[model samples]
Target: MKEKNANSQSDSGYQRSLTNAHIQLIALGGTIGTGLFLGVGNSIRRAGPSVLLIYLVVGIFLFFLMRALGELIVSDLSKHTYIDFIEKYLGKDVGFITGYLYWFCLITLAMAEMTALGIYFQYWFPHLPTWVPGLITVAVLLFINLLSARLFGNLEFAFAIIKIVTVLAFVVLIAFMLLQGKSTSYGPVSFANLTAHGGFFAKGGIGFLSGFQMVIFSFVGIELLGFTASEAQNPKVTIRKAINEVPVRIILFYVLAIIAILVVIPWDKVSTNSSPFVQTLGATGLHNAGSIINFVVISAAISSTNSVLYSAGRLLFSITFNEKGKWNQTFGHLRRQLPQNSLILSAFMIEFAPLIIIIIGNDAFNFISSTTTSMFLIIWCIMLLSHVAYRKKTPEEELTDFKMPGFPVLDYLTLLFFIAMIVLLLFLPENRIAMIAALAVFVILAIFARIWRKEKTE
Candidate 1:
């Protein structure tokens, strides 16, 4: 066997014991949980069964996006990830922007997932303080993050399993209910559920446009492929396989799951209480419906929280790699070649913010989404620009294995879609303030970047 060297340190202390099944389901878990579980009604209200169309449209765009990143990252065995590719294809300035913005994406994603967990626990322990589990969950994830890369991989594998099984089980139970001719006050299971109420696109053109924001939110963390590039056993093959299969997985897990739920409950009647998963399964009068989905969601949230910390911690580690960062070059070196110091720091900050949020007792979704919405848009913009640069820099011939299907057209559509999502966000009553706040965060981060650069020059 040839000497097997470790790649860059973005995967944290975790290494690549993850098998094909592990990577696929972990990718599934990263994107499928809390949002799809709970946000189904929100999507329906925006586009109705038309939201199913939205899922296909958005999933296609994400497939191209992931393939673009995967095509570039899979070339060498160095474990250099998409962030590294950004630096290589674009200038250092562009790379730094991508890396920093991606870091924000990771942490804010963690905050969002952790926020969901706190809310779930409050269901059972109604009298107990919300922050107690928030505090404890953060602590536990932080400790787990400090271990070697494979340790983290194993943990994510198990966490992702909980979600996959629950969703599959939920689908089966829905099928069973429909077969039994079950009826709710809403109506009975009938083929008409697909076409009867408002004829699929019940909300019309404007509602369909408005639904993309939540649809994009459902697909947020699927970029775990880029983050895991550093530790994939043979990213040359593993990342390729993972990225190549993006389209099918998105359709199967997200699209199919949504179809299952819509068939079981009319788009008009799905509840906002708990997850749509709970409402669909609970209708079956199965044993402990609330408890079953609550457990699945809890596991999904924990998996999301864990995966984000691992991905974000690695990006934090990269900052010190710059000659300008406070840590010496040695800081970039991981013991046993893992990202120990960076993981510790990233884990601390991630946990700290939520404890503060918990202490403040501001548990509303909009409160957290405001800070993150801007952060997410900023990252999306960076990734889009990075791809443009990649297309410009990389020669045409070596692009053989995989390239985005269309040059400027598909890429441009995806870009425009992201812009429209941001615009739609402004129209939302609860999210409107967040849209405004996100603008301010962008300005502040830009100004901070300028000042930091000036100080480096001085």
Candidate 2:
């Protein structure tokens, strides 16, 4: 492997304390968020068993997309992120828009995770205010992150292990129930649940398509692997191994878990008001299943919030480093190689999650969830476009062994998939407002970038 700048302590002037294990676990922690633990309930309700197919399809496309991302970063190890390549290949305007959008995007997602955390808390303390636990979640994660980068990694690793074990145990429990010919209200614990209840495509084509919106959203944090590239121990080997294993992990964690739930309890029994995992386990006579699943999903939410806050901080630090302004400079300050100022600012915005919950009450999580998913899809599309541009400009000799499969063709197809997702968002009544919000945010940011550029030129 090419080793340029590989030995530098801080390749991008940021601490590189994350090891291969940390990279893998952080990626896992990020991808397997509250989206799976809670949001899957809504998806299962929407499309019945057909949601499984949606998950599989979205996972395949994202895996290809990550390969494009991995190839670009490893090809030029010195660049902090694909944002750098975005500027080089696409233009300064796109890079500027994407940088700000990406930062704001993850911050918005942090808010959504915070909202989910508050919901999880309601499971334990049914009468207590959600904002209380929501506030506590932000404070706790903020403190761990402020301590150090390695601490954040270690914390996320622990969170990932909890979720991993929970899902694995879930799969095993469902299998045991099926082996004993256990039956529930929906019928026996068997694969027949997939087709028994109104058939596999029970909800028909539109219902199946609607599920894609949430299904795709569940994988929003998959690109977090690219974000951790700057801090990884061996950018080349570590990233390659992590990205290469995503498919298997997605299958084991997402696909199999969903299958197990539907197999044990019919899709109709999976309530939007609670976790499918909990509901399935409850069907099998586990009295404490609800509390157990509650803790698992809570950990998943906190894990995602922790990872995304770190991401937003890093993105702000990068954008500020490139801008020439006093506030930007302040936000870019580092202490012990941690982006302390940026993190504080990010945390302050995230703290709004509780207040939003208090005001909006019941609808807050779904609203933020749809908005976050829309923004991430936009970012993913931009990354693929940048990748296509990079391949055209670079010499074949410079391409790494980790190159994207079916290069330009797969790139455009993935972009088309994202477009389809956006269109699907328009079809869902709940997502329409969030979709409009995403467009309005983009337009406002684009105008802001133009003014910033004109001011700089003068």
Candidate 3:
């Protein structure tokens, strides 16, 4: 009966075309990509079986964080996404920082996915040059995004289905191998691999802690769900279902999938250079397994890249929609009811990703992974803090139905977890550069915000 954010329409008049299926699939597609398929190998190498627990722990905190986000968004159905909530509950300064930081995060992340996509393509055509596919992927997805937001959602649905099929198939293959009592070069395909290494915590506490940086990165895009609130066909029902199922999706897709890989193949045998999923399939005497899995991974990367590009556009548009800043006004404009201005600019930014891959080669993934994990953690911190502030301001009766469990306590604990994660990043040598970079970006954004506010006053 009531219109949520009657004035919340995008400059291009975006339609609420994303159904429950679209939002759910987009959430799955966004979070379950390179992090699980490609990055998990490095995590396995660092933490051994302990990586499973890391996923669980980080996932649990993320659940609380999302719960906080869901309640915030539901409280004002008219609001498009969390950016509005951050601005309203927090301050405009904070809202500005959050919006730009989120945009930057998705841009870098989309680039990372593209980098991985090229590497996967090389698995089939080693001589074709990584940048070739990288560029083409960006162009194709850019075109799709420029057409319509609904098309982007539909494309994500297809990409997500490919990933869902691959992971499901991989898990089934593992079950079949265990049933047959088959053995591979790594020895028996059983759960023994989980403990057979140096015990479950084979790598010790330090190694286990190091994995959190990447583990956190793997879950980076889960918050994309909150951003989709504006386009959701039924925000109340769709957002509710999507956010509620996040933990279960993490368990089934992330936790169970990793466990199955470890069970079938010793963690030590998995190579960071290639996907553990690809590696496991190849290890099962499937000669073309590498090629097959490569195709699947290519699809996964494409899926992730597509979603983030869409996210980057929306984030940029949100900033411009709320402010009169020059760049915001430019990026915020729409044509043919699409954020074409923001979408093309975001795509252009992503084009540089292919160059980064060619320059650094394999290290591109590692660098982007570390940098983004730190950045996403910071974003989560703000999200939770904003939620707390929102709760304090709103009447208890208003949040009656979409209540966040463990409100103040869980909220505080989630914030602490994020702080601990930032501290942990400092101790990690590989992540140290990323930590510094994240800090520098935050400082720069804050100073810029201060100047903008001062000028506005004058």
Query: How do the residues 345-420 of candidate 3 rate in per-residue lDDT, one tens digit apiece?
Result: 9899989987788788879989988888888888889989898998899887666488889789999999999999
TM-score of each: 0.88, 0.96, 0.96
Q: Once model 1 is optimally superposed onto the true structure by TM-score, how far is the C-alpha of residue 209 displaced, in angstroms?
A: 3.1
Q: Least lDDT summed over 10 consecutive residues: which range in candidate 3? A: 3-12
Backbone clashes (count) for model 3: 2
Q: Write the residue-wise lDDT of candidate 2 on 381-440 in tens digits.
A: 899999999899889988788899997889999999998888879778879888878878
Taken over the whole model, the C-alpha lDDT of each candidate is 0.69, 0.84, 0.84
The residue-level lDDT of candidate 1 at 411 comes to 70
Candidate 3 error regions (>4 Å): 1-12
Q: Which window of ten consecutive residues has the lowest lDDT sum in model 2?
A: 1-10
In angstroms, give how far residue 154 of model 2 lies from its true place. 0.7
Task: Name the lDDT of candidate 1.
Answer: 0.69
CA-RMSD of model 1: 3.2
Of 1 and 3, which scores higher on lDDT? 3
RMSD of each: 3.2, 1.7, 2.2
Q: How many steric overlaps are in each model, in order?
A: 7, 0, 2
